[model samples]
Target: MAYVIAKKKNTDEKPFDYLPKFHTLRDGTEVILDYYDNQDEEETYRILKDIVDDGQSYPQETMETIQEFKDYYLSHDAFVVRQAQTAEVLGAFYIKPNFPGRCSHLSNAGFIVKPSARRKGIARFMAQNYLYMARDLGYKASMFNLVFVNNEGSLKLWRDLGFVEIGRIPNAGNLKGVGFTDAVQFYYDFATLPQKQ
Candidate 1:
């Protein structure tokens, strides 16, 4: 089978030299997106750890140590979003290859927006930046392997951003109280990404 290769980033904490950029959320709040750094590590880990313990979205259930967080998130191209003025981290994400070698052009990403930052459009903003960054890193497409069906907000956001439902897995998410729940897979090709007007 034919495949594509994605440009490799330096195997360091910060893979790309991305300039901090400000974006307005749905409620007109401004947030800055930039590469992950050691300074922001503590706060970001707290956010992700909470989500993992909550058992609603992420697959990994526990992040017991900062090293575990590093091994999982920092191994790839990771970024964080913070409030422009206060510099309070509100969310973070990481883009990594979905497969090895020749299939590395197919990228995958995971996002975490703190509960307090929800409803302000932080996720969408991060997603927009992620798409461009993925393409810039030579990924031809991005695919989300598991999105719980009950996550209406994320489902809506991905669909609105032009991702299509490619497949579904029954009982894919072992949610906290709900037990096994249905999950959907989503896909997007950079080829069809509409140029921002």
Candidate 2:
């Protein structure tokens, strides 16, 4: 009798292999999307700090130092989208498991785009890339844990991208100058979603 052994697979490949290093926006601006690099830490931190300060989308406390921001990025599968020419960090996002143990198959993602970068399709581009990354990372589903109801743009974008409102937490978020608002949870199942050509 002959004995055969199977080879073990390498599971440490880059997570964002499906994404390109350079993507051209609708306005013809070339943007680079990749994992965060230490060299771009300052620029990335600036963008995140601005978002936290804006108080329009993300809910959070202040990041007093760059190290704090860097540590936050390192805690998740973080990526930055930047201007290829000027190397300006336009947007960034992080994807991670929604919970530990059996629920780990479900992933969650958060996004932040600079004020100058908004209304220019960056969010849509980042979201599309995020879904691809999530699928490639072996996540069965993706969810935006907290999409404020007052954020009509995001709610509309997520819906248009095939995400369904799975649940909602009433008065879960306090929008700046707008009192309390509901936080809607959106979900997308990879098996049901059509692959992007």
Candidate 3:
């Protein structure tokens, strides 16, 4: 995979160059995390489609076909986490500008983990890595645009990572078989984040 070196505007540092290529989970399972590569497009689409079809967390109703998925991911900084031994895509995410000019310093991100891979630290790993990449890419902060209020696990994880609830939209999400729930917007400012010990 080709790593992109993003130079912070008006500066010479490329902090993201230090991103890790592989991570070992608590159970000793090795996984590779990297930018989206054309070679893995089909597999990545399959994993994302399955997550959308499940219709539990994501907001989209219809799952995209492989071609459509490819088009969408190509327009964003999409990343994937894959099992090292079998090369199976365990999770995926994408980061994009939250809005056009003047607001481009703020980014929005979305994540999906295979059903079999949930609760295995893949989400946390992806979030941490993405934040590092975002910071290096000149994003002042990262935001979760619409986190369903009922998703306690995601809420807890984001909060633990220092994301704060900035706004809430009541009854804005229709969860599968769960009717309507509030959607929350969470934000994390890289500047004020506490230093890691």
Candidate 4:
């Protein structure tokens, strides 16, 4: 794929296949969403850990899970995005079939943006982009599971993006330093929303 230079700095660079224009701030800080390559997969492990590793964050299965995801994507489709320059993975999310065979059109996804990048619209960008990608691949909908009820940022983002709160699992996750929190299930129907121009 031809990667476009979404954003640029004084340093030399190449284009990114899927990211949008990189924007520069008044202080000269540039933010770009570059594709997550194999070289960056290891860093993704630590990034995923830092964000989802609440007391309820699942175990070291991340490596295996990511590897499995990579393998699966070899025959399917997957995408991840990271903040350029710092290489500190901003957040990575992808679309995958909910099941094999007849259920392949139904998709599932998970998202995680680094703590520092919160409120910066990275999550929104990822969600928006993934929806288009999913539609292009003929997906019917996107389902997100285990969203912490206390995660106001994501809850609001998904809701604004057209994901509905279909169910809630009581006391599903331990809030690490705090007590347990309910896990809310969300679903996004691609056919229900207008396409981004």
| Candidate No. with top TM-score | 1
Q: lDDT for each of the candidates?
A: 0.87, 0.79, 0.78, 0.63
Of 1 and 2, the candidate ranking higher by lDDT: 1
For lDDT, the strongest prediction is: 1
lDDT of 1 by residue, 1-197 (tens): 95443444566544456558878888777889998878999999999999999998889979999999988887778889998889889999988898878778999998999899998888988988888888887899999989998889999999999999999999998899989999999999998866541
Residue-level lDDT of model 3, residues 1-197, one tens digit each, is: 64343321333332445544789987789999876666778777777788667666778776668767855554557778989999888888887777666777998777888788888999999988778777766789988878888888899999999899999999887778888988889999978744441
Which of 1 and 3 is ahead in TM-score?
1
RMSD of 2: 8.1
What are the per-residue Cα lDDT tens digits for candidate 4 across 60-122? 223346655444332244345555576556677656676666766777766666666666777
Measured over all alpha carbons after superposition, the RMSD of each candidate to the real structure, in angstroms, is 3.7, 8.1, 6.1, 8.9
Question: Against the true structure, what is each candidate's TM-score?
Answer: 0.89, 0.86, 0.85, 0.71
* Residue range 55-118, candidate 2, lDDT tens digits: 6677775777887876665565778898998988898887777776678788887788888888
lDDT of model 4, residue 7: 18
List candidate 4 segments past 4 Å from native.
1-29, 56-76, 84-88
Q: Candidate 1: lDDT over CA atoms? A: 0.87
How does residue 65 of candidate 3 score in lDDT? 81
**Candidate 4: C-alpha lDDT:** 0.63
**Quick one: ranking by TM-score, best first?**
1, 2, 3, 4
The list of candidate 2 runs beyond 4 A from truth reads 1-13, 195-197
